[model samples]
Target: MLKIGITGGIGAGKSIVCRLFALLGVPVYDADTRAKWVMHHDKALKQELTEAFGPEAYTEAGELNRIYLASVAFHDPQKLELLNSLVHPHVGNDFTKWVEANQQAPYVLKEAALLFESGSWEQLDEIIVVAAPLDIRIKRTLQRDPHRTRHDVEAIIAKQLEEEEKIARAQHIIYNDDQQLLIPQVLQLHKLLLSKI
Candidate 1:
C-alpha cells in the first residue's frame, strides 16, 4: 500500500483535506491525535516525557498535562526538539504497526503538522500540502479557536515551516482557499495515485 504524508501549516486546512481523503476511502492516521494517545498510554514515551519535562508532565489522574508542557516547550525551541526526539520515534513505530495491520488499503494517509520537522516525510511515498493565503489561514484559525488571540495563532504559524518551503517539497498541492472547488482536485489525485501503484 502507498503511504502518503499530508501536511500544512496551522489553519492551512490539513484536517479538512484529510477528511476528504478519508471519505474517498483512504485510511487516514492523524499523527497529532495519535501522539496524544501515545503520550498517555505508551509506557516508554510517558516515562521519557516525564524524565525530560518533570513530574508535571502528567497529572494525578495519569493523563498528560498538556497545559504545563505547552508552556514549557512552546516557548523554547530546544525543549520542543527534545520532546519531539522522544515522541516522534514512538509515533513512527506505532504508524508502522498500523500499516502492517491495514495492508489492504489502497493508500494510507498520515496527517501531521510537523511531518518535515519530525522527519516523518521519509516514511511516505509522496507528500501533499494544503495551501491558503496567510491572512485566510489566520482568520480561519481565529474563527475555529477563538480562545486564542490573533497573535497567538500567528505565533503558532510562524513556528511551522513556510508555505513556500512546503510547496517546494510537496508532490501534490490542494488549494483550499474556499475559492477553488476541492472535490475535483481530490478526484484527480485519486486517479493519479492509483496510476503510481
Candidate 2:
C-alpha cells in the first residue's frame, strides 16, 4: 500500500480534502486526532508528558489538559519542540500500527499539520499540500474557530513550514481557494492517485 502524506498551513482546508478522500473509501490516519488520543491513552506517554510539562498536563480525571499544554508550549519554541519530541514518537508508532491494519488500501493518507516540521514526511511516498490565499486562510480559521483571533491564526501560520517550501516539496497540490471548485479538484486527484497504484 502506498503511504501518502497530506499537509498544509492552518485553515488551508486539508481536512476538507481528506474528507473527500474518505468518502471515496480511502483510509486516512489523522495525526493530530491520533496524537490527542495517544496523549490520553498511552500510559508511558502520559507519564512522560507529566514529567516534561508538570502535573497539569492531565486533569484530575486523567484527561489530557489541552489548554494548559498549549499555553505552556505554544509561546515558547523550545517548549513546543520538547512537547513534539515527547509526543511524536508515540504518535508515529501508533500510525505504524494503524497502517498495518489498513494494508488493503490502495493508498493511505497520513494527514498532519506539521508533516514537514515533525519530520514525518520521510515515511510517505508522496505529499499533497493544500493551498489557499493567506487572507482566505485567516478568515476561514477565524470562522471555524470562534475563540481564535486573527492574530492567533497568523501566529499559528508563522510557526508552520512556509507555503512556498511546502509546495516545492509536494508531489501534488490542491488549490482550496474559494474561487475554485474543491470537489472536482479532489475527485481528479483521487483518480490520479488510484491510477498510480
Candidate 3:
C-alpha cells in the first residue's frame, strides 16, 4: 500500500483536502485527533506525562487537562519538545499498525498539521500540501476556529515553514483559496494518484 503524508499549516485547509480524499475512497488517518486520543488513552504515556507535568495532567474525571498541559508546555519550548517526544513515537507505532490492518488499500493518507515539522514526511511515499495565501489563511482560521485570537492564529503561521518552502517540498499541491474550484482540483489529483503505483 502507498502511504501519502498530507499536511499544511494551521488554517491551511488540510482537513478539507483530506475529506475530499476520503470522499474519493482513500483512507485517512487523522494524526492530530489520534494524538489527542493517545494522550488520554495511552496508560504508559499518561504515567510519564504525570511525572513530567504533575498530576494536573488529568482532571478528577481522568480526562487529559489540555489547558494545563499547554500552559506549561507552550511557554517552555523545551517542555513542548519533550511532550512531543513522548507522544510521537506512540503515534508512529499506531500508524504502522493501522497501515498493516489496511493492507488492501491502493493508498492511504496520514493527515497531520505538523507532518513536516516533526519529520514524519520521511515515512510516506509522497507529500500533499494544501495551501492558500497567508491573509486568506488567517481569515479562514479566524472564521473557523472561534476560540483562537487573530494573534494566536498569526503566531502559529509564523512558526510553520513559509508557504514557498512547503510548496517546493510537496509532490502535490491543492489550492484551497476562494480563487479555485476545489472539487475539480480534487478529482484531478485523485485520477493522478490512482494512475501511480
Candidate 4:
C-alpha cells in the first residue's frame, strides 16, 4: 500500500483536505492525535517521558499532564527538541503498525502538522501539501480558535516549516485558498492517487 504524508502549517486547512481523503475511504492516520494516545498508552514511552521530564509528566491518576508537559517543553527550545526526540520514535513505530493493519487500502494518508519536522515524511511514499495564503490562514485560524489571539496564531505559524519550503518538498499540492473550489481539487487528487495504485 502507498503511504502518503499530508502536511501543512497551522491553519492551512490540512484537516479539511484529510477529511476529503477520509471521505473517499482512504485510511488516514492523524499523527498528532496518535502521538497523544501513544504518550498516554505506551508504557515504555510513558517511562521515557517521566525520566526525561521528571515525574510531573503524568498526574496522580496516570493521565498525561498536557499542561505541565506544554509548560516545560514549549518554552525551552532544547526541552522541546528533547521531547520530540522521545515522542517521534514511538509515534513512528505506531504509524508502522497502523500501516501494516491498513494494507488493504489503495493508499493511506499520514496527516501531521509536523510531518517533515518530525522526520515521519521519510517513511512515506509521497507527500501532499495543503496550501493557503498566510493572511487567509491567519483569518481562518482566528475564526476556528476563538480563544487564541492573532499573536498566538502567528507564533504557531512561525514555528512550523515555511510554506514555500513545504510546497517545494511535496509531490502534490492541494490549494485551499478561498478562491478555489476544494471538492474538485480533492476529487482530482483522489482519482490520481487511485490510478497510481
Tell me how many clashing residue pairs each candidate has: 0, 0, 0, 0
lDDT of 3 at 38: 90
List runs of model 4 lying over 4 Å from the truth. Answer: none
68, model 3: CA deviation in Å? 0.5
TM-score of 1: 0.98
TM-score of predicted structure 2: 0.98
On residues 94-161, what C-alpha lDDT tens digit does candidate 3 reach at each position?
89989998888889999988888778888899998998888898998999999999998887887688
Give lDDT tens digits, candidate 2, residues 140-173.
9999999999889889999999999999999999
Report the number of the highest-lDDT candidate. 2
Every candidate's lDDT? 0.93, 0.95, 0.89, 0.94
- Determine which window of 10 residues in candidate 3 has minimal summed lDDT: 154-163
Please report how far candidate 1 places residue 106 from its true position, in Å. 1.4
User: Per-residue error at 129 for model 4, in Å?
Assistant: 0.4
| Models sorted by lDDT, best on top | 2, 4, 1, 3
User: Model 3: which residue pairs collide?
Assistant: none
Error of 2 at 124 (Å): 0.5
| Model 4 quality (TM-score) | 0.98
Positional deviation of residue 55's Cα in model 1 after best superposition, in angstroms = 0.8
Residues forming the 10-long window of minimal summed lDDT in candidate 2: 185-194
Judged by lDDT against the true structure, how good is candidate 4?
A: 0.94
Q: Between which residue pairs do clashes occur in model 1? A: none
